[model samples]
Target: MFTPVRRRGTEILDDPNADAALSLRSLRDIALANRFFGGKRAVVREVATLLRRHSGGNEPVSLLDIGTGLGDIPAAAARMAGRRGLVMRTIGLERAPMLAAAAATRCTDALAADAMHLPFADRSIDIITISQVLHHFEDAEASQLLQECTRVARMGVVVGDLRRSWLAVAGLWSSSYLLGFHPVSRHDGMLSVLRGYTEPELRSLIERATGCHAGVTHRLGFRITAVWSPRYRRA
Candidate 1:
């Protein structure tokens, strides 16, 4: 067992040429973690708020979920929207073809697309979500990614990721074993905690990237979520 330092480090999943089975296994574990913990719940709550605000309309809202590995978050949001009487059309984007294929099973509208270069027009999507994916990028790329997210979203964007803390690392380590996560999952989970950002750090990064006032809130299970609506209208 290797002890991860309290610093950002690349996980094997970051590699484009990694093993497919390992990557899918890790994604499954991640989906389970988000489901049991507050990852999926946090995004669902934010989506619920937006749904309520955009209610009283027959038109279905379009939600584009970026880096939707197993499509758990968007799938959950779509299901929740149905229960709340809000019509939603959920779409998931995954850069990896295999990931996109797997996500398509969970979300019918999944596509293979890059987060940095979204295919949608400006302000085309009602809502956009990026879950547990930000920590993989450096400062500059993260900022660019946020800008892209802001560009496509007409209403708001939801970002959920791990919060950097020793407690979080230990919790992930213990829970991975308890929950029967894969070996790669365990390693990547711990590394993700180490690579995570604090609330303030995330806020600054998002604000810089999107050029909008955004607040990052720390939630249960050492997760941090930011819900930001662009203040300025798209040109």
Candidate 2:
């Protein structure tokens, strides 16, 4: 329920080593340090439930989790999809080699690749998800990535990310110290808040990029979640 801001071009922030450092930390601390994991779990669960309900029975589902830092959500999706006799074929894509290696240990398949250029063929994936990852891209790249997600996904795309607000900033700052996260985690967490897009802004970008409107909603009070499908497809 956030309004769109005036569109403006911005520089993309690159932190190639950020995910690598996080991977080196204690897994427990990494999970606790990032508040979005819990919210992302809920969102993924809800989406899985919806997909199952819509599919009318359990069927194999392929999921491409872009920017899957630690493969948590993809792993969760695999479990959820498994209940319906659905083979959860998941490919976790990460830019950092260390994170990709860590993710491979967590999930069966992991690939190191750029978000802007996914290795999958068009309409090859059932679902494409980006959790707490899109804000790392600038406006233009974010739009392009959205298009790529749509191109690669046959069913739908789900985005789970923080909603930029002063309250969010304050919460992140307090929790960073409380969780004893690494210095880079705390610093990047705060900066990510500042860089995050409101729900409307995300919707506008999706609409402009895909020439199709998208639905945006807030999740877990402070996270912005969006779901978009191709114009020919319904979600």
- TM-score of each model, in listed order: 0.94, 0.84
Error of 1 at 206 (Å): 0.7
Candidate 1 regions exceeding 4 Å error are 1-6, 232-235
Q: 40-154, model 2: which lDDT tens digit per residue?
A: 5645855674475346355567888887767777887887777766777788887777768877865668988878898889988888888777887777898899989989988
The weakest ten consecutive residues by lDDT in model 2 span 4-13
Roughly what TM-score does model 1 have, to 2 decimal places?
0.94
lDDT (Cα) of model 1: 0.86
Q: How many clashes would you count in candidate 1?
A: 0
Worst 10 contiguous positions by lDDT, candidate 1:
1-10
Q: For every candidate structure, what is the RMSD over all alpha carbons to the true structure, in angstroms? A: 3.0, 3.8
